[model samples]
Target: MIKILLVGCNGKMGTMISTVAQNSTTLTIAAGFDSKTEGNFNYPVYDSLTNVKENVDVVLDFSRPATLDSICEFVLNRKIPVVFCTTGYSAEQLNKIQGLSAEVPVFHSANMSIGINIVNNILKTISNTLYKDFDIEIIEKHHNQKVDAPSGTALLLANTIKDSIEAETEFNYGREGIAKREHKEIGIHAIRGGNIIGDHEVIFAGKGEVIEIKHSAISREVFAVGALKACEYVYDKTPGMYSMDNVVNDTIKF
Candidate 1:
């Protein structure tokens, strides 16, 4: 069994991971790291990773960007693999994460849902085929408690859409007064309210036809399950950086 040191173990996603792992035959929660360690967990929860002594095979991180430094330190020191599922990291932090991969395995993604990664591939094909005839816009929705706008998955999809086309593609966050859509720009809009797990819609507008590709996450369980799959994939791997695309392609799955 793979023993996981779960970061953000007291949050909704953390609890969900624990819940999912309980039914798995090859996974176990070794321990957890969280600021709020008061929750009743099957494994011990510590306020920090500095004092952790668990025999963990891998780490599953869903914590804030603020906790990244300590998480990196722990993984580097222990030479353990890690799956970082948190988004909204600054460019410098992302560089640090890539650097850490040189020493230990690191799996990071903007979003961890398997369906979203499938949608990523779908957008690539659609963008390549529709580039000459369609104008594209992306709309994303998330819970009000979420701090980042444009949800990382939206950016992931936007970048895939941008790179698939031969011509230059620019990103427009949203339209304002007197602003009109440009031929080479992809518009991204964000909406926040209520308890939306997540929602993303990609609209392709053509002369007389419009196509919308959408993915809606009904619950946080999808992300949690994806992270668990990443944990399994990275558990015994060599040092390298990985993404959900690797898991989707069955690179590590037997």
Candidate 2:
């Protein structure tokens, strides 16, 4: 069995992951790290990684970016692989994550849904074929409680399209005042309200028509399931950085 040390175990995603692992045959929760340590769980929940009492094969992180420093130190010292499902990290924190990848297996992604990963791949193909004649715009919607705008999945889609076209594409996040759309710019818009799980739409607009590619997440299970798959993949991987694409290729077909 692969023993997973789940960070942010008391939060929504953490609880969801633990609930899923209860019926898992190959994966088990060995320990958890969270600020809220008062809870009834099959495994022990520590106030921090430094307080964990059991050995674990891997770490699954859904914690805040503020705790990243401590997380890096804990994993580096133990030589353990980690899957980061948290979003809204600054550029400096992202660089720190890249630096840690040189010493231990580090998996990070803007979105963990396998469906979204497949959408990323499809967008690449579509962007390459239509970018010359079409203006690309992305619309992403999430629950009001979500902390970040443009959703990480929106950026993932934008970057995927940017990579495929091999052009100097600038992202314009919601316009202000009066300005015409730039040819090489990708417009990204965000909507936050109600209890939307996730919804992303990429539109290709031309002179007379438009084409849209979309993916919608109905629940948090998709993310939890993807994180488990990432844990399984990174358990024995060599020191390096990985993404959802790597996990998808090894575990399932597009």
Question: What is every candidate's alpha-carbon RMSD to the true fold?
Answer: 1.9, 1.4
Deviation (Å) of 49 in candidate 1: 0.4
The global C-alpha lDDT for each of the candidates, from Candidate 1 onward, is 0.92, 0.91
Worst 10 residues of 2 by lDDT: 245-254
Q: Which candidate number would show the highest lDDT if scored against the true structure?
A: 1
TM-score of 1: 0.97
Clashes of 2: 0
lDDT, model 1: 0.92
Q: Identify the runs in model 1 with alpha carbons over 4 angstroms from their true place.
A: 251-254
lDDT per residue for candidate 2 within 1-254, as digits (tens), equals 99999999998899999999998999999999999998889998899677887989899999889989999999999999999999989999999999999999999999999989988878866787898899999999999999988788899899888889976788999998997999899999999999999999999999899999889988899999989989988899999999999976766664
**Which candidate should be chosen as best, given TM-score against the real structure?**
1
Instruction: Write model 1 residue lDDT over 59-141, tens digit each, in one string.
Output: 99998999999998998889999999998999999999999999999999999999899888788777978978999999999
List candidate 2 stretches off by more than 4 Å: 251-254
